[model samples]
Target: MTRRCIVLLSGGLDSMLAIRIMQEQGIEVEALNFKTIFTCCQDQSAQVARDLGVRLTVVGQEDDYLDLVEKPQFGRGKGANPCVDCRIYMFEKAKRFMEQIGADFIVSGEVAGQRPMSQKRRDLDRIAHHSDLDDLLLRPLSAKLMRPTLPEREGWVDREQLYDIEGRSRKRLIALAKKYGLKDIPTPSTGCSLTEPKFSKKVFDLMDAPGESRRWDYELLKVGRHFRFNSQTKVILGRDEAENDQLRYAHQLSDANSTASLFPENFLGPRAMLIGPRTDEAIEFAASLILRYSRDYDAGNALIRVDDEIINASETEQAKALQTIAAS
Candidate 1:
């Protein structure tokens, strides 16, 4: 019988190379791609699966995935990314997938010592143990340096064909990609917002907020310019026309957390969403921001629309000052 394995395909050079190695050894491979709100490379994964001639399964993070992001047991990296906890969550799901599909083992592209947060030698052992795939999980790119997994030990795959690649250098990996005739070698990137410093700041701010941040709050982070009005209130301003439409649509959602939407009624200006009480003062503050960003700023006290009612913009100085403080 032909051996089969499930590969965690992240649409990167390493995962693609892993699939190639499995194919070279005549092992049937199935690709699995995991997605979270912070990840943005599903399309690339799908394309890579097609290129590799492997069946692909796409799985999204469950609500519990947020728990790790909010408070990672292993702490975080340079950014908000909880790499160790996040990988454990993914591998746990992959274990279920492996059983569901009757695959003999699971494989990934992780190189030992490649990633500071998640791919340390000790971290790899912790992930395998925690995910309950102790000897079933294989990292083909670094297999030679680790204990043989079930596949290798059982002769399902040749340990000699596995690699000992580790660390941050991609010189060997790039050469291997060319040898395999793989095209469109993607550049190295985590493709996750949680790994970005600026975005991490926003995530940390939300985490530090008084109340628990909802999924909607996290989703909104991708859409607008966020401003904290107080412990109970935040304002989001659209930076472009498309984002303005998104804000309008988001505010109208049945489960939206926004209390009010603001825009310039008589002049061109960016739209804003209020995520807390739409008090008169908050509305005025939001409108003042609209005025500051409006194209026709001198169009005599900008007429601002607050949901259905029009209000004269006020608190211009206060809004400007607050924005300055936030930026600084």
Candidate 2:
């Protein structure tokens, strides 16, 4: 029987190259892409897999994924990204898939010292060990620089055919792509919002706030400007018409925590959602915000539909509450 491998294809040039290398050795390759709420590259992955003529399987993160984000065992990177822990999670799932499909080994494009968070030589070993792959896991792009894996030891894969590329430089990698005759080299992208500093600010905010953070709550973070009224109260205001439609739909989710929604009935303004109470205080705040963001509305002209009631946003409210946090 010919040896086979499952490669983690992130729709990037590195991963594409990894799969090509395996094919060069006559190893049957199946590609797997791990998906999370923060990941936004499914379409790209699908297209790349089709181009490579490899079957692709996309696995999603389970709710337990939230636990690591809240309190990572290995800690976080520059932002809220738990890179080490996240990779371990992905590999643990990949290992299950590998066994299910009887893949001889697992492959990734990670190079030593290429990523500060999880691609260090030591980190790679730890990830492999913890994910229970150990020598069964292979990094073809940097294989020669490291100890031989099971595939190499068992003569299943030729170590000499693998590479020794390391660090952040892409010069050698681009040359290798040319060697493989790969066109349409993909540009680098983290593809996960957790890696963005601004986006992570909102993530940290939700984690710190009172009450359980649900999927809907996290989804709203990607929508618009956010303001905190208190531990039990908050507001989200859309920045544009697209965001306005998104907020309107968010309020209707079965599990949405929104207490009320503010829609501009007679004037142009953003649609806003209230997270907690619908008290006069929250209503007044939400209304004032709609007006503040409205380009062509005044206090008297601003008519906001609040649940079943219509309220006039006063340019006259004593003072707007101090903004706890802005858009992230």
Candidate 3:
């Protein structure tokens, strides 16, 4: 009987190499790509799966996955990424998929010590144990340095063919990719917003805020320039025409938490969304932001739309000063 294994495909060089390695050993491989709100490489994963000639399965993070992001057990990295807990969540789902498809084991491209947060030696062991995939989870790229998994032990895969690659260097991996005749070798990237410092600041800010941040709040992070008005209110100003349309669409969603959408009615300015009480003060504050970012700043009193009502811009000086303070 031909052995089968499920590979966690991240659409990167390492994971692709792992798939190719499994194929070289005559083991049937199935690719699984896990997606979260922070992830931005689903298309790449799909394309890689096609290239590798493997069946691909895509899974998404559930709402409960947010619990780890709020507070990870093993803590975070340089950014808001709770990588250890996040990987555990991903593998737990992969374990279920493995059982569903009757695959013998799970494989990933994780190289020990490559990632400071989740790829540490101890972290790998912990993730395997926590996800209840102990001994069944294999890191093909670093298998020679780690303990043999069930597939290797049972002679389904040759341990000699496995690699000992570790650390942050990609020299050996790149060479291997060329050896495998791969046409598209992707550059290394986490491709996750949580790993970006600027985006992480916004995530931390949302976490520090009083109320619980929902999925919509996280989604909003991908668009607009965010400004904190108060503990109860934050404003998002679209930086471009595309973002302006996104803000308009977001504001109209049935589950939108925004109190109102503000835009310049008679002037060229960015659109904004208010995610709190629609007090007169809040509307006026939003109006000022519109004016501050508008191209036609000389328009003495710009007409601003607050939801369905049109109001003249107010407190221009105060809003300009606030923007300066925030920038500083």
Candidate 4:
């Protein structure tokens, strides 16, 4: 029987290459893509799997995923990315899939030292051990540099045929892609928004704040122009209509206490939402951010609407709010 393998395909160059490498070795490959609320690459992953002609299974993040996001066992990276914990969650799921299908082992495109957070050699081992894969997890790209896994030792996979590539350099991977006759190679990117510097700042701000609920706060991070008004309060202004709608939706997620979702009552300003302990001060701070993003209509006063109430905001209030919002 041809050895079956589960490949974690992130739709990136390295993952595509990993699947191809397995195919070249005559291993039957089933691609698995993990999806999180914050992950942006699922569509790309699906497309890439289709292009590769592999049967792809997409799995969603479990509710317990929020627990990992809140208090990651391995902590966070530059942003709110709990990469190590996240990978462990993914591999754990993959292991279940592997056993369900009677696949011999798991394969991944992970290259040692390629990513600062989760791709370190030690982190890789930790992830495998914690995910319960131990030596059952194989990274073909860096396999030769590390110890042979169960797949290799059992003759399910050929150890000598695997490569020893390491580090962040893609020169070797690119050459291998060429050798595999791959026509389109994707440029490398972490694809997680948590890696973005600005996004990281928001994540840290949330982490430092009190009473930060996991899923609610994480959802807010995905939308709006975030501004920190103070340690206790921050504002998110919608950049467009979709974001405007998102603000309204986010505001409804909690009761009147958790978040005081605010809107512009009088003016043609953008929608603004706040996630924090709602105080009178926090509400006003949120109001100010709304006015800041509002366009100056010919009318001096703008009508702003909060949940059930409306307030007429004057130019003076708008200006003060703009200053406050900018200072944040």
Candidate 5:
């Protein structure tokens, strides 16, 4: 019988190489791509699965994912990223996926010390144990360094054919890619918004707010200049045409918390989404921000559309009254 394995293909070079190595060992491979709202590059992952001729499965996190982000049991990285906790979550799912598909084991491209937060030798061990994967999880890139897994001990995959690569250096991995006749190398990145400091600031803000931060609110964070007026009030100003369209679409959602959306009626400027009360003070504040970021500020007679009505920007105070939380 041909042994099968599920590889965590993140569309990065390391994961791609992991798949290639499994194929070289005459093992059947399936690609699994896990996506959270904050992750990027799914299209690239699809293309990679096609190049390697393996079936790809894309899975998304449940609302419980938000719980982990807000209060991580294992703690966080430099930013708000809960790297260790995140990996455990991913693998717990992968373990189930392996069982569902009747795969012999799970494989990943994780180098022993490549990631400071999650790939430390001890961290790797913790993830395997906590995820309940244990010896069933295999890191082909650093297999030689780890104790023999079921695959190697049972002769399902040759340990000699696997690698022992570790640490931050990519020279050996890059050379191996060439040796496998692989092209289309993707630049290395964490591929997660939580890893960025500025993005994490907005995440912290949403989590710290009084009420719940639903999916819509987190989705909005990806597309605008965020400003906090108070605990219950905040405004998001689009930075470009694309963002303006996004803000408009967000306003139309049935569960949208945006009390009112303000758009430049008589001048060229960004749109704004007002969350919380639509008091006159808040409405005028949104209008003032539109003028503050207007590309054509020379148009002194600028008007703002609130709902279906047009209104002049009354400077309740000033657009810069509150500190800008996140830009664009």
Candidate 6:
């Protein structure tokens, strides 16, 4: 009987190498890609799976994923990323996926000590033991340094064929990729927005707001000029045409309740969308941010609109009012 394994494919060098190693050892491999609203590399993962000729399974977090984001059991990383908790969630799901598909074990591209949050040796152990896949989970890229898993003990896989790569170095992984005849390699990145500091501020902002934040709000953080008006209010101004459309799209998200979306009604300025209470003060604030990005001071006054209704304000007045409003 051919042993089966599920590899967590993240469309990165390490993950591709992990799948390749499993295939070389004659283990049937399946690719699993887990997505969150904050994750931006799903397309890469899908394309990599297609290139590797493995059947791909895409899974998304439940609404409860928000619950974990709000408060993680292992706390958060540098940003809002609950790395340890998030890994536990993914691995726990992977465990169920293995049972459902009758796979003998699970594999990942994780290199010990490469990542600060969840790839530390201790963190890896906690993730495995807590997810209840202790001996059933394997990290082929670093398998030689760790204890052998059930698959190795049962002779379903050759322990000698696995690697023992460690730390944050990519030299070995790059070399292995070349050996495997892989090309067009992707640059190494955490592939998660949660790992970024600026992005995390917006995430933290959304989480701190009451009855206003949702997945939609979080997703829009990836595309805009984010400005925190207060703990309860924010205005995202689009920097260009692409962002302008995104701002429009964000306004239509399920949980968003902005009273009016502000746009450049008559000038060549940026389009700004408001999220939070749309009081007269908030609308004025949004207008002020819109003016800050405007080059239409020569137009004497710019006519801006909210919900298709126009408000004409002099460039100087708008700027002065916004500064006063922001300070108050």
CA lDDT of every candidate: 0.88, 0.89, 0.89, 0.82, 0.88, 0.84
Which lDDT tens digits does candidate 4 get at residues 1-328?
A: 7988999999998999899999988999999999887788988998998888899999888789888877898988877889999999999999999999898899999999999999999999999999999999999999998989998998888888899999989999999999988778989887888778777776667777777456667767777788776777677888888998877776766432236566665446688776566676677667756766766653355666666777655556556675663311
Stretches of model 4 off by over 4 angstroms after superposition: 253-258, 277-279, 298-300, 325-328
lDDT accuracy of residue 280 in candidate 3: 77
lDDT of 6 by residue, 1-328 (tens): 8999999988999999999999999999999999998887889998999888899998998877887888899988888889999989999999999999999899999999998889999999999999999999999999999999999999999999899899998999999999887896899987888888878877777777777455676677787787767767777888799999878876776666655788877778888887777777778778878888787444466778888688875665565545643210
Q: Over 4 Å off in model 2, which ranges?
A: 318-327
C-alpha displacement of 201 in model 1, angstroms?
0.6
- Clashes within 3 Å, all models in order: 0, 0, 0, 11, 0, 0
lDDT of 2 by residue, 1-328 (tens): 6999999999998999999999999999999999999999878989999999999999999888988888898889899999999999999999999999988899998989998999999999999999999999999999999999999999989999999999999999999999998899988898999999989988998998888888888878889998877777888988899998998888888988999988988987789899987799888888887777776776566788998898877776414733434544
List the lowest-lDDT window of 10 residues for candidate 4.
Answer: 252-261
Better lDDT candidate (1, 3): 3
Position 240, candidate 2: lDDT: 90
- lDDT per residue for candidate 3 within 1-328, as digits (tens), equals 8989999999999999999999999999999999999998999999999989999999999998888999899899999999999999999999999999999999999999998999999999999999999999999899999889888999999999999998998999999999999988998999999999999998988888888888988899999898887778888999999999999999999989999998888878899999888887777777777777777545566788887888876656445635543310
RMSD of candidate 6 to the true fold?
2.6
**Superposed Cα deviation of residue 36, candidate 2 (Å):** 0.9
In model 3, how large is the Cα lDDT of residue 132? Answer: 99
lDDT of 1 by residue, 90-155 (tens): 999999999998999999999999899999999999999999999999999999999999889999
Cα deviation in Å at residue 69, candidate 3? 0.7
Model 5's C-alpha root-mean-square deviation from the true structure amounts to 2.0
